[model samples]
Target: MAPKDVMTNCHAKSILNAMNALRKSSTLCDVTLRVEQKDFAAHRIVLAACSDYFCAMFTSELSEKDKPYVDIQGLTASTMEILLDFVYTETVHVTVENVQELLPAACLLQLKGVKQACCEFLESQLDPSNCLGIRDFAETHNCVDLMQAAEVFSQKHFPEVVQHEEFILLNREEVEKLIKCDEIQVDSEEPVFEAVINWVKHSKKEREDSLPELLQYVRMPLLTPRYITDVIDTE
Candidate 1:
């Protein structure tokens, strides 16, 4: 054979490191992505390779295809920098401080790996105080697994969760949905009933009408006979 092909195991990583170096030095970068009035120099090819959002913009007939500078609105500069770090280095730091912002940015960029990382971080950070909020956030972002995890965490700590302001602020529908779930862990039906009353009393003017409807799910049969004769009858 006149020639034989050779492949280097470190070739990919070596190229990435070199590209990162060039990007930091502003060498041979073909595009500038501006976010929140901050400029980030990068190669269109590199960005396209990592994110489908960038790929579509660069390959399509849109006006941005040939534009040397593109402004990405609704994205913070810090979030953009974190995303660029992930694209160039194949790694990212997903922390509580940045995750809320980073996950949305990653979602917009079509970076599934980064989004999954953010979801995992949120899942790990779930607690009685924040589980309800995290559950809503996960649902809003379509992170099904994280949402389920947060839901379970909320129900597992239902007694404590009811003490948080997030629980008190829930609208009628959300309150009803949680109390109806069989998965909620409570010492007894007393806590369940109390949770419902507490949520309603938080905004009585707007929520009092729904109390009668929510009370129907309190599972009267599950309540102790003494509670019915004493607490339930009085309330």
Candidate 2:
């Protein structure tokens, strides 16, 4: 083999050795640290070196079986740089994927910087358009704080978004669908749901009260003789 090929093989072997060392390392907090299969080929070395830090933040194993299948092949250096910066700066844009995983990791290792980043990201992303997905992600990751923030954002923005004719006309089933989609709890005793229900009720009541006034304006006046004579006498 050429010298370049020999060097490449040596580098690959070294990375594999580092990964094995990480896999066999003692659990930091009763959680096994294994390279995610999706991240193994390219990021195994980097991830393995960071295992102890990750273990400190995460209670669950880091094995491939735990997370959804994702393709990280196209991850750019810039992305990694941003992630690292977020970890340090504790500020990040929340629209990035796999944030659920990243946030936990940040919390576990006492990466207050990263945790702050996750919070900021979630705050910015919490809105009527994407609140449901954010709520799901938070619940799945057991992120209570994120969930609460999302609830607040949804409740604040819901009135403006749900006042449309389509939303006003939604049946119970349709409303439930929106609730589920937005990750808003329909059965929970939380104030968020309570506030939403109150808002809807108030809007409906206003519409109902306006109907009588609207009818009075549209109705034709009666042409009774008594009313005509009264009007003539007044004239």
Candidate 3:
């Protein structure tokens, strides 16, 4: 070897350990976070280093910079605890029970890593029964990769997905969007036609206006002549 090289501080574990100890002991903590009736002591430097929201609050000439105790609105105490733990530990347990709530809280705090973890967790949990809901949730939260993944999975499993109770819960526009997808798989057009009819019948007052538009998505030529005649008579 041209020179002897040495590696130190594997994974920065020592630094993280010290920071975690500070977090636990509340030593040198300069700020108090009040979230949904609970308080958490935290260091400004650590929070600023981890979150843009906290960074702006601490670094700016804003009134919050001088405040010893700040109230964080719209997040529950438990969610705040998890957020603080991630800030100190650089890790979090994203579960089905928590991802839905955690994603929004992470987004509010501008914690990109936790938000991304929630999105990844949601992506891994997609299934025929939940893909649509997950897709909607991802879209609502502006998670592009998770939204696309859920949308594609839902489209590919549209036949099976539509049979789920969640399908009937989809509003008129959502139903239209799914029906218009060319990638939706079905052995025959009958299922698609029957799904549309069932959706319309489920809430005629709300869905009747879209019946004519919904019917256009069905492949009439592929349906049996008898069924086609029966549809025409009903129309």
RMSD to the true structure for each prediction, in A, is 3.4, 16.8, 2.9
Residue-by-residue lDDT tens digits, candidate 3, 82-122? 99999988899998888888999999999999999999998
Candidate 1 similarity to native, TM-score: 0.89
Residue 153 in candidate 2 has what lDDT?
64
- All candidates: TM-score: 0.89, 0.34, 0.90
lDDT score for residue 74 of model 1: 74
Among residues 3 or more apart in sequence or in different chains, the pairs in candidate 1 whose N, CA or C atoms overlap within 3 Å are: none
lDDT (0 to 1) per candidate = 0.88, 0.47, 0.87
Clashes of each: 0, 7, 0
Candidate 2 per-residue lDDT over residues 7-121, each given as its tens digit = 3547655654554454345212122222333222223324434445543323346454234332333334334444544432334555468566667655554455556667668
Indicate whether candidate 1 or candidate 2 has the larger TM-score.
1
lDDT for model 3, on a 0 to 1 scale? 0.87
Query: Which candidate comes out best when scored by TM-score?
Result: 3
Q: How would the candidate models be sorted by TM-score, starting from the highest? A: 3, 1, 2
